[model samples]
Target: MKIKVVFLLVVELLVVIVVVVVVVVVVVVITVAIAVAVVGVVAVVIAVCVLRVNFVIVKVELVIVVVVVVVVVVVVVVVVVLVLVLVVVVLVLVVLVREVTAEVGYSTGSSVLELVFVIVVVVVVLVVVVFTISFVVRLLVVAAVVVVVVVVVVVVVVVVVVVVVVKVVVAMMVVVVLAIVVVTIVVIVKVFVVIVVVLLVVIEGEQVVVVVIVAVVAMAVVVLLLVVVVVVVVVVVVVVVVVVVVVVVVAVVVTAVLVAVVIVGLVVPPAEQNF
Candidate 1:
């Protein structure tokens, strides 16, 4: 009985050891499977995060591109509008000039002489203006020319009329002097003495000096008027030259700018396609 009991205890110890070994092996396998599942879940989460970040970056870049396109379109439209406005203004000015010229050229049928005079005056004024340095200088020169011309013309006419009227007086004086010369020799001598005395008094007196001074002053006034006219003409000419130079330079620069704009406009993609 003692031996049988000992054998039974040994058998029970072996079965317990085998069962514990089996249970330990099952627990290790289950832990390994759980670790693999956790690793897979972590990998999936990281991949999702990376993909989401890339998607966000792409969306932001797209938005930025869209905003830039919108701004460029707006700028192009504004530039085009401004250029059109400038063209219209230039056209209007050209038309107005043509119309005014036409109207002046065709205005009246009966006043041909008057029209010719007017045309001549206008041409003279334009010539003077074109020669001047600035608009203000041109105006001043034109005014001075008109005033001087009128004054000179009036003075010349007056002098001519005065000379004509004095011709008879000068002829009578000559005849009287000749008659006195033919009269009595003593009477001629006395008359000659009296004339000499009177002539000496008038020529040597302050009155004669005053008359000379007045004549010199009148001549100086005329000379001064002439000088002013010449100076005005010179200034007008210089101004016109300067204006022409400036206009040429401005026209060249504007033409270059226009050409550049045209090139850019043609080369650039259309507004809708630029985006």
Candidate 2:
């Protein structure tokens, strides 16, 4: 009789231990899935949006995305199979607990209904905890994805602004060099005109000097406008990049802290229950 009671106690402990293990395993699997999904989505975005920037980086990100997706799918399928097996195992254990409790109750003349109720309550609480943890994991995944997207968008915007700034600088440099060339030509024409007007007394030389002066003035105005435009663009781009980087950094830090908190919650509870 004592042996049977000890056996029943052992069985009950096993049931609780098994349920806790299953819960931990399921949580772990789901966490991995969340990580993979978040990372894969980020990689895909980087690969697609910034493909022209760096071929090697894009290719590497794409490969990572593919590997992450494959790993996630395999993990999910395995978790599903594991859950099914756990359900079967739990049911079998429940039946065994019931039979053992019945035999013990019949011999010891004690009610078995209380033990059954406790088992049901434990199972229900575990289910609720699992669902809660799952919900938190989902939220974490969404937060991580949002953080990544913001960072990526900021980076892309920075790249675009830098590209535009570079092009503007190149265009401005070309305009400045062209203006200097035009000024040099205007000076040469003036000297030639003086020589020609004095030596040859040609009427067309004065008109040619006037035309060259007007062309030089026009080039100077165009160069001034380009410089002003370039300066404004550079200032605006610098300000925007600074603001965006700050915002992205803050968002990433907050998201990371939240993820860490949720991970601790998941890990600590299972460990405490197991002990």
Candidate 3:
């Protein structure tokens, strides 16, 4: 019985030792499981952080790409717009050239009409000048006729006076006195007619010169007016062309900038999301 009891006690001690070992093994396994869980949680957290970082990086890259794309697109659009505008301007210039050519044709016709009108005016002026000169000549001739009549009357008066003097002097000395009186009357009549002809010729010549000067001034004024009209037409066309080209260029540049911005927005990452 004593041996049996000792054996029983030893058995109980072995059982207790086995239970302790089992408990220690269970505790170690639980600790290992908790450590594994913690490690997994940490790994998941790290993965999430890494993924968030990557996502942010991607978003930033997308934003950058969008901006770059927008810029590129805008530049291309601007270039295209500029080219279109250039083409339009070139077309406009071509049209302007055509219009100018047409205008030139019209102007040529107008110039021809003006030339005809000037010719008519010149012919009329020439006719007027001729008429004026003829009228002046006629007046001068009339004046010459009057002067001739006056000279004849003066000669008649002088002859009558000489005759009376001769009658009175005849009683004193007859032949020499009568011959001197006749020679003096003839000389005075010739001198008076010559003086009147010379004065009339000089006045008519001066009037002709004045008429020619006035005609020349009128022609010069007509020519000046035509020149001014031509200059104004050319200036207006040039100014219109310049303004059109400037407007087209400005529109193209603005359009290209807008296109580039849009393209960049589509390609690049957003600024707020970028690291």
- Give lDDT: candidate 1, residue 166: 32
Candidate 3 residue lDDT tens string, 127-171: 333433433343233323323332122223223323322232221
User: Candidate 3: TM-score?
Assistant: 0.24
Q: Which 10-residue window in model 1 sums to the lowest lDDT?
A: 106-115
The TM-score of candidate 2 is 0.34
Query: Model 2: per-residue lDDT, tens digit, 57-95?
Result: 445444544543464455446545655665566566667
Looking at candidate 2, the ten consecutive residues that score lowest on lDDT are 106-115
TM per candidate comes to: 0.22, 0.34, 0.24
The model with the greatest TM-score is 2
lDDT of candidate 1 over 228-269, digit per residue (tens): 543553454345334433443443354445444434444565
lDDT of prediction 3: 0.34
lDDT of 2: 0.44
Cα RMSDs, all models: 55.8, 39.8, 64.7
Residue 184 displacement (Å), model 2: 93
Q: Report every candidate's CA lDDT.
A: 0.34, 0.44, 0.34
